[model samples]
Target: MTHTLVQDEAAIRALFTSLVEGMRERSPARVVARYADDAVTFTLAPPLLNAGLDARDPEAVAGWMAGFDGPITIEHRDLSVAVSGDLAFVHGLRRLAAVPVGYPEGFSMWTRITVGLARRDGQWLITHEHQSVPFYMDGSFLAATDLEP
Candidate 1:
């Protein structure tokens, strides 16, 4: 496919790249910095709905990062970024790879991701983000975490 991102789309892509960098670094401040003050997020964790940056709370994010043994790497796949005016959204898959503090064996999981962004004051900020994994349709409705892209 002949894909050439426009200026806005390029900027948004860069923003996502930086966000991933922050996540790998496990820096709460940097991780949350790309989001707007009232950005809503539905993470892989509990709570059906997160009203604002609650999902990206500095303390909560830091605690979660602490659960990992070392750096947390995120790889985005099948990414689709669309931009129109000041509103934009990205649909993609994110693979999180990390080793837990107590578990010597590392883990890697791919989750569906959707990120909504809006341009404010000539800057692009994440206004919403949702991440989830599919669930088995069998008798046991457990999350399908072992799937690969």
Candidate 2:
């Protein structure tokens, strides 16, 4: 059991690495490959939640990724993973640094993330992903994008 847990953790870690590489390489297909066929996401984007099918669409995904002026860089920090049987969950802070096509100044923000994964065919795949940036309690209610981990 100990050995299996270690292996599982390593595999999960590799998935995050793949995600970073995919984003950096501007390959939507590569990034979506980490997810299951039925994956769902509550992304930083609008509409509250995004369908897995939408994410799987290479053209659409690529279009959004292309908004970046160049390669997109992301770093995962203070990540925590827990595994039990074929289910796992991870929570962490992700820093997304990018230069949008129209924004020469570029930008970077830290978002809280929670991901749920399931083992299918002996491979772990992300089934659900949620991301958010805390909002101020004050009347402004603006997202605290300026904060860091």
Candidate 3:
């Protein structure tokens, strides 16, 4: 790897760090700010896919954030980042744990995460993101979140 690659990797890592911080803060706006205007996300939510943060109501994102209460802790492992000029991508396994403030405790699970970023005007912004949990192919469909990296 060259010096530029090292720098790119550092920058991308910083971006993910910021994302984790934002989640810990429990501020949807803060987290959404890290995404590009045209950002697309495939998360653990319904509707399957979301496109353009600006196109959706801010409350939509806030509602999702509001589902979680207390401090949100996330751990990323097996991280791999690649960069080529203004384009970059990072993929890893993420474990998230949080409890709902007013409700019963929630379950903690690990999911696969991949985020695509673009350097726009010297700043790295997430352009696309996907989070998934593999499922068993047997007769019963079950998430394989119990697996560890």
Candidate 4:
């Protein structure tokens, strides 16, 4: 029983690592595979001003890959993960970078992200993820007012 549990943990870690790599590659197909067919994503952007939830069908998820103009990069830190039965969650700090339109150079942002995973049919997969940027008065990343949408 202990051996089986250890194996499960390793498998889950591998899957999560793959998912991160895929995100860095800006390959939506790889990212979508980590989620269930009916998985939904909520994005918090200032322009959107509200939490926008999108039901990710295969086509929708695949199309999302087209939105990136250039490669995406993610650096993870202080990663903590735990699994309970068929559910698992990972939390950590991330440095995210991407090239936006009209910008010759890319920009990087730091944030904290929490990912929720569920095991289905003995395979671990991500079900949900939420990212938040902490606002500090010390002028670290972004100010609290900057986060206002």
lDDT of candidate 4 over 29-134, digit per residue (tens):
6766777654445544433222222433445545554545677776777777887878888887777677766668876776777877788877787677776766
User: What range of 10 consecutive residues in model 3 has the weakest lDDT sum?
Assistant: 53-62
Model 2 gets an lDDT of 0.89
> What TM-score does prediction 4 earn?
0.71
Q: What is the C-alpha lDDT of each candidate?
A: 0.87, 0.89, 0.82, 0.65
Candidate 3 lDDT tens digits, 1-149: 33488887888888788778877887677677778889888887777888985424467867777777877887788899989889998999999888866778776889999989998888889899999999988967998877777
Given candidate 4, what's the lDDT at residue 46?
31
Predicted candidate 1 versus true structure: per-residue lDDT over 1-149, tens digit per residue: 23234988888888878878998878888888888888899888777777665855888889888888987998898889988888898999999999999997989999999999998888889989999999999979999998998
The sequence of per-residue lDDT tens digits that candidate 2 reaches over residues 1-149 is: 33488899999999999999998988888888988989889888876877768746678778888888976999999999999989999999999999989885889999999999999988899999999999999999999999996
Cand. 3 Cα-lDDT = 0.82
C-alpha positional error of residue 2 in candidate 4 after TM-score superposition, expressed in Å: 8.0
State, as a TM-score between 0 and 1, how close model 3 is to the true structure: 0.88
lDDT measured at residue 87 in model 2 versus the true structure, 0 to 100: 95
Q: So what's the TM-score on candidate 1?
A: 0.92
Question: Can you give the TM-score per candidate against the true fold?
Answer: 0.92, 0.95, 0.88, 0.71
Error of 4 at 137 (Å): 6.2
Q: State the local distance difference test value for candidate 4.
A: 0.65
